[model samples]
Target: MQNKAIDFKRQVNIKLADTKLQDALSRLQTRFVEGRSAVISEIHHLEDTRTAAAAIRDCVLNDLDSWLQKFEQQAIAHGAIVHWAETATDANRIVTEIAAQHNVLTAVKSKSMVSEECGLNDALEHAGIKVMETDLGEYILQLAHEAPSHIVAPVVHKNKEEISDLFAEKHQMSRKTGIAELCLEAREILRPAFLNADMGISGANFLIAETGSVLIVTNEGNGRLVTTLPRVHVAITGIEKVVPTLEDVTTLLRLLPRSATGQSITNYVSVLTGNKDAKAHDGPEHFHIILLDNGRSSLIGGEMQEMLRCIRCGACMNHCPVYQNIGGHAYGWVYPGPMGSILTPLLSGLKSSPDLPNASTFCGACAAVCPVKIPLPDLLRNLRTRQMALGLKSRQEVLMLKVWGWLTLHPRIYALATKIGVRILAMMGGERHLLHTLPGATGWTDGRDFPAPSGKTFREMYRKKSTK
Candidate 1:
């Protein structure tokens, strides 16, 4: 993960200068933000709903032990096998073992970020099983050998023309294919995979503790097929996804789509409690649920606990100034934006991604748009504090900050330094209000000019006015 942070700085430089990439990000981010704003306006008491949703999440997280135990008992009663994974390795091994035991040659999967987090496809393939992604965006990314740029809109970074080229090269389709035609071709390819797959795996939007059910919402009907058509169905999700009741799920469902894709409701919402009952013969006969902890449990009583309240709506990224500039891939991880900034360090360790928390401008746009109202800016600041306390920052940076702090505490020396600094910069600026070059800050001056200070200091002017 530390390697990823080191790469992030390099990637951001390239991405910022790519005009085509910037254009695509601007258009798509605007669309999502506008759609969400419009839908939110139409809903009555949306803020109240957000508050209630936050409270419910807080309740479940506070007493997670009780909720998880009850959920496990109820799920077992419903004929679903429950498995607990304390780490990503455990999760991948569990899913692979299930495939191996059932003699599953092929597995079809819906959009599951948890699977990405655990690297499930690679694990399954290593065990000699074929895994096919059924969601259109996910399938496109899988074929291209790329990770998702956005949470809900996995391939948002890609344009239709690029996709047409990919399909033509990989699927032997004509390069002049249209958007609708590409989708149809993908459907034709995936339909057979779905029918032949011996195992189906998915991620849950919310897990119901009362009913022992997993709720999946998607625009495409692929989620329904993945959970129902195969002989064995498996759901892998974070333990934080569990809710106490269906009514709590209803409140969250209303916020999920509206905040995620700006829809009143998703096209498909599949609720699977167990596999098949006595009357049902078509659905998966064997059902399994894998609850993954993967560093989430350690955050329960910590400052980052608020991060667990995220619903994965992508609203924070959509509104983030930094994310809008560099895009998600530049973050170099499964999650991105303000949520990713906090989560990456917390889950991976503050020393791993020391620069992530500092990536923000602290504008707080992410906090404003977050459905669960996680104070993202505060959390990010806390990460920075942790990093500094751990001495993770470079020695040069720490020294500069310490010098600045000492000067700030000494009023007379600070005033004298500011006066001298203003005169020097003003002399350098000459006729211009901006400095095109600055020592030790080439990164800031390389792309844009820095404002030059005025010739007169505020303290001098204040003294002159008082004497008059």
Candidate 2:
């Protein structure tokens, strides 16, 4: 597999320079931020619910094996087939096997990060099955041949004009302006795909073990169509998505929308029990639930287990300074933002994505706003420590950290080194008060301006204050 992190950064840099993309990003930020803030302000009990939700997740993670088995039993009893996948490859193989057995020619997909993780579309395509993404954001990205830029809003990186152009080229339609027109254009094309698709795949927002229901919350109706319209429905989700009951799911639901896009509830929250029963009018004949482990089993007893509590709200990404600047693709995986920083390395391994865990500013925004109260910043720090222990950090960075560690053990040298570093930066910048180019500071200055450090060190200031 290619290193998506590197490519994501390169793509972001290119996108950031484009005026249209910048405008679209700015508008998207304003819309989501304000909307979410308003929703949060309206809900006085949101924080309390978040606490409850966190506790629920804590309990689930603690007894994951039991909960998973219970979930499987309940789902199977309801006429759903539950398949366990220990790895991404296993998950893909399971989905492919099902499709092949059904003689599926085309599959319609709702937005599912688990599917993205398994590279499901690629696998299906390689197997000679056409897969179409039905979500508006995902559909745009599919047309553009790009990965999702946001967990919820996958095509947040593309501007209206770019989307218009992409649609025009792909479908041979005339370019149009305005959101409604663009949406209509997309609807015109995707409606047929939904009706004609052989199989439908989706990701569950929450899976209730008590009732054997898979809950899909969406602003658009695509998820419902995807799950019910096709002959076969496959729901792929992580093992951590399991909850004990609808009441537990309700607690999460209360916090999820407010923290995500700030809605009271998303427009659509469809609870699917199983395949279409004799009494049902419209629904899939076969319902397959693929529970993907993909390194989550190893994280169960570790400090990073808290990461699995994430509700995929995208609140963290919306509030994330790095995500707001570079967008989701930069994380180089299906998940992005503070959650992604921890998850990408854990799922993909630190060696495959050495830069991911270190991509954080550790601002605590993700943790503060998390609906399930996941300690994202702390988990990120833990991942960084693990990465360092594995010797995945750059040689220069490792040597610098070693020298710094040595200095810290010896206070006199630490003070001396700090003073010297300040003086050197001050001399290099002169009166500009900015170092445009510095050996170690290039990354900082690449996208944003970096201020030069003041000549006076904190130690020097502290010493003078004590003397005075």
Which predicted model would earn the best TM-score? 1
Per-prediction TM-score to the true structure, in the order listed: 0.97, 0.93
Error of 2 at 462 (Å): 3.1
Worst 10 residues of 2 by lDDT: 1-10
40-155 in candidate 2: lDDT tens per residue?
Answer: 86766767877899999999999999998988999999999999999888999999999998989999999998888888888889999999999999988888888887887888
How do the residues 292-361 of candidate 1 rate in per-residue lDDT, one tens digit apiece?
9999999997778889998899999989999999888888778888898888777777776777899899
Per-candidate Cα lDDT values, in order, are 0.89, 0.85
Model 2 CA RMSD to the hidden true structure, in angstroms: 2.2
Which prediction has the highest lDDT against the true structure? 1
Worst 10 contiguous positions by lDDT, candidate 1 = 1-10
